[model samples]
Target: MLIGLEIKNFAIVSNLSTEWHSGMTAITGETGAGKSIAIDALSLCLGERAEASAVRPGTDKAEVSAQFDLSNLPLAHAFLEENMLNNDDNECLLRRVVCKNGRSKSYINGSPVTAAQLKELGQYLISIHGQHAHQHLLKAEHQLQLLDAYAGHHNLVNAVSQRYKQFADLQKEFKQLEQQQQQQAAQKQLLEYQVAELDEFALQADEFEQIEAEHYKLSNSQTILQVCQRELQHLYENDEQNACSILQHSAQQFTELAQYDESLASVATLLSEAAVQVEEASREVRNYTEQADLDPQRLTEVENRLSGAMDLARKHHIKPQELVGFHQTIAQELESISNNSSRLEQLEGEIEHALEDYQNASEQLSASRHQYANTLNGLISESMANLSMENGVFEIALTAQNDRAPNSLGFDNVSFLVSTNPGQPLQPLAKVASGGELSRISLAIQVIIAQKVTTPTLIFDEVDVGISGPTAAAVGKLLRQLGKSTQVICVTHLPQVASSAHQQFFVAKEIADGETFTHMLALNKDGRVNEIARLLGGDNISKTAKANAKELIKAHG
Candidate 1:
């Protein structure tokens, strides 16, 4: 239930605060007096789209916040707890801010959140029926929604939707498999030939690099052997002027000097280490040179291997290093082509199973909807009779369409047909019902559906729009009854409707500081009488109007 609303600089409402209580609260005002502004503020708190124009001309931003009592609204509490936004107290605050630059922000329980979350919480806290809600009844899709809502078939609808999704997903997989089969079939011969060619090459990992290395070694064996011998001679075997011989002479000179200065001993050790290292290096180089002789037979074999790799790589439009990967890919493609028929059959079988599941769920859903259609028609017709249309005939016509492809909502088409006169034949609401009758039907449907709604509050923006007389009284009483189980707030102009509110708020416009402003005040009993009397008598309230207002109030009480 909504406990409070605070709005600042929103349109003409500059810093308005109001406390709400349980039960029906009627908001009354003259035209252009900002009754709808209050509803708009509530909608802003409920995550409606905000525009820069919503801010007053002199203000930089507009803010609207609503407080809800969560003590009895279990669904709201669950939502808050699930989101970790629940506070210690059994109350939640929803806040919205709209900047003059057309930016908007939303909050729940002082925690910043997205507009979608606010909308989600708003679903559990408030349901609004605006002045144009009657036109919604003209749409068959909306009628179907209304029927399902009234029948409390939310779970069934969800089940059917889930089944449809399963079927759709399976069908998508089947189509993709079929397409893959067709594509692969067209390319199968080419792929098989490629695989055979690659297999004939018989490429192995690391063979290309190893063979190249061997080819390099065999092709340059004589040069390598000579270089090795030259290195060995330069290091140690060259006469007198080689690096090892020069180092030995320097070591001798340094050793003699160190002998004279006591550092000569360390230099002597260095000369000994240099001679030993040179000898070992010379032996290793000689060993390699002796083993470096070429074999023409092995050389020819390596050249043949490299030539084969290059030719095959060129033929396949790839480098020699990529041959292994190309071979693997072709092999996998051949395997898949071999298994494509079996895979398609597998997908088809799964699709058939999914189709069966979807058909079962949809058929059950259709049967349930058809069964509830009669009950809903009877309830709506009776509700219309209570609203003073004693001859109203309502029918929920369900057409099972076999040729129509199953959609997310199932295979049945639902249309609402109505007749407002005794001898009239039932026709579509758009073709048959007058504006007043539409309003009544809309109201009757709302009243019937409200019983099944778990939301704790509902707002009606002058549901009595095209209604008056006894019918208006009946609408007001129906709202009051709805308020018995849910918090009801109605913005209305009719005294008959306003009189039925447990609480009343009178809205009026004021010209302050040369700017238009809107203000709302909670009306006490005396104030309620005066407001209702004003609604009855306009600017001139007579004793009879006051008396009639008092009688209407007393009767509603």
Candidate 2:
């Protein structure tokens, strides 16, 4: 419940602080007394838009702060906990500051927050009915929403939404795939030709390297043979002074010397090893010199193959090494085209399944709505009669536009119908209900749905406008009754309503220091009497009006 409100430099309210009780708090003042100004200040805490003009003429900024005792507002508490916004006190503070520059900031529990967060948290703490709130009930969309809330069918509605979303997603995917398939079908022949060319090459990872190595040997064979010939002539073909003959002769001399001296024995072993290596090297060189032959045909074949692969890579805008990955990509595209018909068949079946799920959920929701609609109509009709519409008839007409495409809310179109007079035929509430009648209707519906509203505080801004006499009294009584379960706040001009408040505040303008200001004062019994009497007899207080005010308070008390 809202515990208090403080306003500073806001509009005509230079500064005002007012405490509120649990039950109905009726706010009353003379016309232009800034009655709604209080509500406007509260609106800021509720995340309503602010303007620079809201600031007092000489002030730099305007501020509005609200306090709530969340001991009973579990929904609000849970929201705070879930969002990690709670301050651990079970008491929440919301503040809004609007600057003359049109910039605004909000704070929750003294922590900085965005305006949107305030609004989200506000939904669970306070529900303020603007003066024109009743006008909304006439719309079909609003009607459906209210009906759903009253029915407590949120889970069922969510199921329908989930199913509808699935169907929509599947339909979207199918369309995209089908469009792509049609595009690919046009390129089918091109893809087939490309794949055939690649298949002929039949690329092997190791084959490229091997072919290049063999090609190098064939291409440079002439140069290799000349170098080998030079080496062999110097080492073995030098007439009688060849390397083999010298090493052999040297080794035999060392062996003969080693027989005469011990130090020559080591030198003899070294020369013998040198003679064997020289002879082997001479034999291999002669063999290579004999077999060195260039083959142009093999080299040409390898060069053509490499050039072809390079040209393909260039056409694909890729490096020669990237051909493998590109080949795999093209293969997949070809496979997709081949398997497309079966894929389309699979998508069609999946779409059907999604549609079936949505249909089942929507049907279930519709059934529940129909059952609850009758009971809701009967209750509102009774409330309407109690609020002075003697022959009022309230009905919820559910029409199924079944052939319409699937939607998140289902296939039903809800309309609120009303017949304010006996001879009148039931018609759309928007067309038939007068402004006063709409107010009454709105009040009746709100009262009926109060139990379903999770918000702990309900505020009505002159909801009794265009109503008087017994009807005003009944509206007050109903509001007071609602206040018993949840905190109710109403701004009213009627003495009947003001007299019924468990707590009453009078808004009045005062002048001091050459500046005008609006202020609120909580009314005691005598203050209530004077205020009620003033409401009855204008600025003049009369004895009869005072007596009437007393009787009104007595009856309610």
Candidate 3:
């Protein structure tokens, strides 16, 4: 139940804060006096899309806050708990702020949340039936949705939709695969030849770099051997003027001088180390000269291998190192195409199974719709009789579209049929009902559906648009009856409806210093009489109007 609403700089509402109570509350005001401003503000808190124009003429933003008592709303409590938006007390505060730049933000319990989250939670909190709700009753789709909502088998309806989607997706995949079968077969043959060619070469990872180094060495074997032999002769093999012999002679002289000067000892040590290093270098060179030998046959084989790899890389339009990765790609494609026929067969079986599942769920939903349609027909028909059309008959016509393909909403085409007079034949509601008759029927249906809903609050924004007099009284009675169990706030112009509410609020527009503002005040007993009198006779109230207003209150009370 909504307990409070605060609006700041929202449209013509500069600042307004008010508390609400359970049971029916009537919002009444003269035309163009901003009667629905509070409703509009509450809608913002309930996650309605915002517009910059909603802001006051000079303000930068508009803000609205709504508080609801959650003690009786376990669904709402569970929602807040699941989202971590719960508070210490059993209450929920929803806030919305809209800026002048057409941007907006939402909050739950002072925690920032997405507008979508607010909408999701709004389902369990309140349900709003706008003034134009009766207009949508003319649409076929809306009729079907209303029937389904009234049926209250959302899980079964969802199951049918899900199964239909699965069936449709499989059918689409099967069609695409069937169309590509011939093209894929042709590509498969070419891929088989290319994969076979790569299979014969069978290049290993990193083998290209190793083989290239080996090929370079074999091609320059003689030069490497000659260089090693010359280095060996200069460093160790030559007896005179050799590097090792010269360094040894220098070390002996330095050693003799070191006996006289200590600094010369260090120089002798360095000379000895250099002689030893030169001897080791000469040994390495001799070893290389012994091992290095040209094998033209192996060289030719390596060169042929390198050339073949390069050629294959060129044919595939890739680098030699990429041959391995490219080979795997083509092989996988070939394998996939080879299995296309088998996959197509598998998809066919799956599509058949999905169709069966869809049909089963759809049949179940159809049966549920039929079962509940009778209940709705009886209830709405009874409701309409009380709404001034005593002879009016309401029925839900369910026709099976067996010839049509399966769809998400199942296989039934639903129509709301009505007969307004005693002798009239049942006809489509849109074709048979007058505007006033439609409004009454719409109200009846809304009342019926609201009874089945678990939402704690229901707001009717001028849903009593077309009817008046006794019929209007009936509409108010229905709303007030609903208010007995759920909170109802109705924006209405009829005094009959206003008097029917447990409480009444009067909205008035005031202009001061060239600025307009909307104000709402809760009406007391005498205030309600004056307001209802104003509704009865307009701005100029008469004694008779006040007397009639009092009588209305007394009768409804």
Runs in model 2 with CA error above 4 Å? 181-192, 220-241, 254-271, 283-300, 317-322, 332-345
TM-score of every prediction relative to native: 0.82, 0.90, 0.81
Whole-model alpha-carbon lDDT for candidate 3: 0.92
Clashing pairs in 3: none
Measured by TM-score, the strongest candidate is 2
Poorly placed runs, candidate 3 (over 4 Å): 175-186, 198-314, 317-325
Worst lDDT window (10 residues) for model 3? 286-295
What's the number of clashes in each of the models?
A: 2, 0, 0
Residues 200-306 of candidate 1 have per-residue lDDT tens digits of 87879989999999899899988888888888889988885677787777788888888569857787778878877888888888888777667899999889989
Instruction: Please report, in order, the local distance difference test score of every candidate based on alpha carbons.
Output: 0.88, 0.87, 0.92
TM-score of 1: 0.82
> What TM-score, to 2 decimals, does candidate 3 have?
0.81
- The sequence of per-residue lDDT tens digits that candidate 3 reaches over residues 1-557 is 89999999999999999999999999998899999999888888888899999999988999999999997888888989999999999889999999999899999999999998998889898899999999999888899899889888999999999999999999898888877878777788889889999999998988788789999999889888888888888998997779999999999999999999989999999999999999999988888777776789999999998999999999989999999899999998888876777889999999989988988898899999999999999999999999999999999999987667989998899889999998999999888999899999999999999999878889999999989999988888999999999999999999999999999899999999999989999999999999999889988999999999999999887
Q: Could you arrange the candidates by TM-score from highest to lowest?
A: 2, 1, 3
